[model samples]
Target: MAAPKEIPLDEIQWHDPFEIQRIGGLHSNTVLFYFASSPFFDGTSNNAIVYNQAVHNENMNHLIHTREAFEGRLREMTGLEFMVAQEPAESGPGMGTGVWVIHKQTRRKREPKDEIIVHAAYYLVGDHIYMAPSFSDIVNHTMITITEKLSKCFAIADKARTWSPSTGHGYNTASATTSAKAHALESKGTTPMPNTQESSTSEAKKPTRSAVDSRLAEHSFMIHMQYGGEYMDENPITGKPGEFHLSSTGRKDKMPTLALPSLNTTMVSSSLTQPDKKDAKAGEKTPKTPTGMSKIKRKKSKAGATPTSA
Candidate 1:
């Protein structure tokens, strides 16, 4: 067999992973391709394309929606059968992930089987969406290694990413994004980065209250009167009966107690013990009809007539 001709090192072309490209039609607005890293370091005859997009679009705003559109596009463009390698999983709160794999066989039957696999993933960070796509020969280490790295990189980058609702394109330079976030927290009166020293000093300076002070704190009461509005202090007595208190705002005055006439115990006792004069006058009409009664009456008449007859 003839020795294969060696290609010069200078002729070798390197793929640029940090290329930025703008794509349209998946969403109403354009999707920004922020960064793409390829895993094809060896010079091979496999035609593979790997890229990443930090995207913002109302239609493709979430991880689920983005995955659908992305996978649909890949199938339509590549005309290959693709399977869901990994379903959308939450890497963190308000974060999701998805991965899809594709296999393509060589066109000719006599030629050795050349399998190509395409891997893609997406992330929903804040209101922004990020997607990663990799294309490589379905060799064990090439496609698998790249896909794992891609997911890890996306998860790590989630913390630094932010989205703005007002602007369709929420992405900004690193320095600008940080400054804008800091300004926003300040305006909203939120402590994005709390000061431990100030918090400790304030806590230390607070004096410990006594038990008596704590007990008396809830002693205050509001006094309400029938005729007037309520007041915080106790009600005071006014001079005259049925009169409002001088200090009282508008409350009704207290009613006065009634005094009874004094009673004479001696006069009450004589009146109860004395006999009526009407009964004594009726005694003269009987005239001592019975014997015993007549004797007694005669003796009384004689004594009254004169002492000489005795």
Candidate 2:
């Protein structure tokens, strides 16, 4: 093998991963590629075809779409299970991703540039099922970083010989879900928990938190209110009745206390001792009745009722 040529950074043709649909290149053994880097396009063609991962591929504005379309044709010609990358590396956010694209005709007002269309014939070499992406642009080229990655990929591909299942392409452990979570944590590179038994025990026993579903106290209360719970005490304008302290956000709930300000005492015998008057007031027509007291409140009309007001 000849020495790998160094790719210049500025000469890379950039593409956006978000523009393609499920876009990612596949090994000859038919495994979809995860993006460790981006694609590149210089003025001339080379062994390196740059691309990205299988995320953020709804937009197809560049040559990446063209590459994607070519890969689709490759899949059709090869019968390989493959798609385009949806996104590039984690760094690709906000930053652009390179992709190849296809457009039928420019608007009639603007004269269109020279368009390339691909037609194909299928031939099977070995165990490889060569199919293609059903589009025009074959490969979306991006930057030199991806070009270098592509060169590495080609070298690896060449050393292993054919795009066969034995190459261990499917067994990529670098960016799997659990490993990805671990890798993401590793990249931030914080210190591990203290090695004391209590700390280690606590860390080991801790449950994975629901980051998306977790809510602030107020947010939880608001959600509770949305479902018909009233938070009258939470209003800043109308403070809660008496001694309750506000939350950090200045919200409050009702506070309970035994002592009444007006009475200055608690009712001890209210239910047990005052059954008669309370039952009477409550309109319970009981088994027993008093001779003078009736169920109705008969206003003693100016008759025998003594007036003793000062």
Candidate 3:
């Protein structure tokens, strides 16, 4: 196929690729999470990232340094940096701490919690990325459903998800994990209601076997970050963009969303139980889904789409 007219490189960055994403009705600062699958960007040799507001300090620091070095190491490797525009690194009004400028540029989905909710994951296999039913979204910082179309541009694969017991964290943690309250209970010895029920459930779910077989144990693949996944693929007409395609198309022409699925719950022992909780208050009213969320967004090809300012 013939390439598009060669526009001057300088003319391009000013507004070159000629593509943009549109997100309406969102709060000015909403994260554009799990949302990339670009044609012009993917064809190049650079490997890039998918991002969310939850970026961690370590990953951010690593990216800045890596990008600086990528300039000099192009002969050996290619890398890129990404960040969701809304969550650009800014000084605080957060968890009692502010991020230094150096930590804001790397586009990694930083998780604030130490709670490693789900361990059973599909990491890279010999050279393939695992395919799954659905994955977590960095946009809303939540999980979304998956489709067959997007699976193509990726080397689909999976792995066994595993986790440490009584992780002492969120809903995914088993009752066997921690105290009912954020802190230890008083000497009263008598625990509260929800915690009491959770303790009982945990006691019954503990597994007797030392190991359990899971899909995450069987496959693996290299990582690529784009929120769109294979459904947004352009190279493969159908699915599964094999290694040959990956070598041919660098990060720009070939990347999927940076997202994964997490198990909602884990079993625990009565002695190790804790409560399952969320940020929202109990029995409180919930907000209605806005019009924008009525349908899942699908990606369009470069030949037909126009870029939106937002």
Q: State in Å the error of residue 173, model 2.
A: 24
lDDT winner, 1 or 3: 1
lDDT of 3 by residue, 32-86 (tens): 1111232222323223332221134554434323333322232233233222222
Model 3, runs deviating above 4 Å: 1-4, 13-22, 25-79, 84-310
lDDT of 1 at 88: 40
TM-scores for every candidate against the unseen true structure = 0.16, 0.13, 0.14
Tens-digit lDDT track for model 1 on 206-273? 75443234434333311223534644556665678787565755767789988986546654565565
lDDT of 2 by residue, 1-310 (tens): 9999976433333333442234433322122222212332121211112233222343422424454554543332221122332323333567643331211111112235423333322111221223223333234444556898999998876544422222322333434657777765663338665567988699778753332233344477687779765555443443577855554555568799788544212233333344565547666654444343457665564977796755
TM-score ranking of the models: 1, 3, 2
CA lDDT of every candidate: 0.41, 0.39, 0.32
Ranking by lDDT: 1, 2, 3
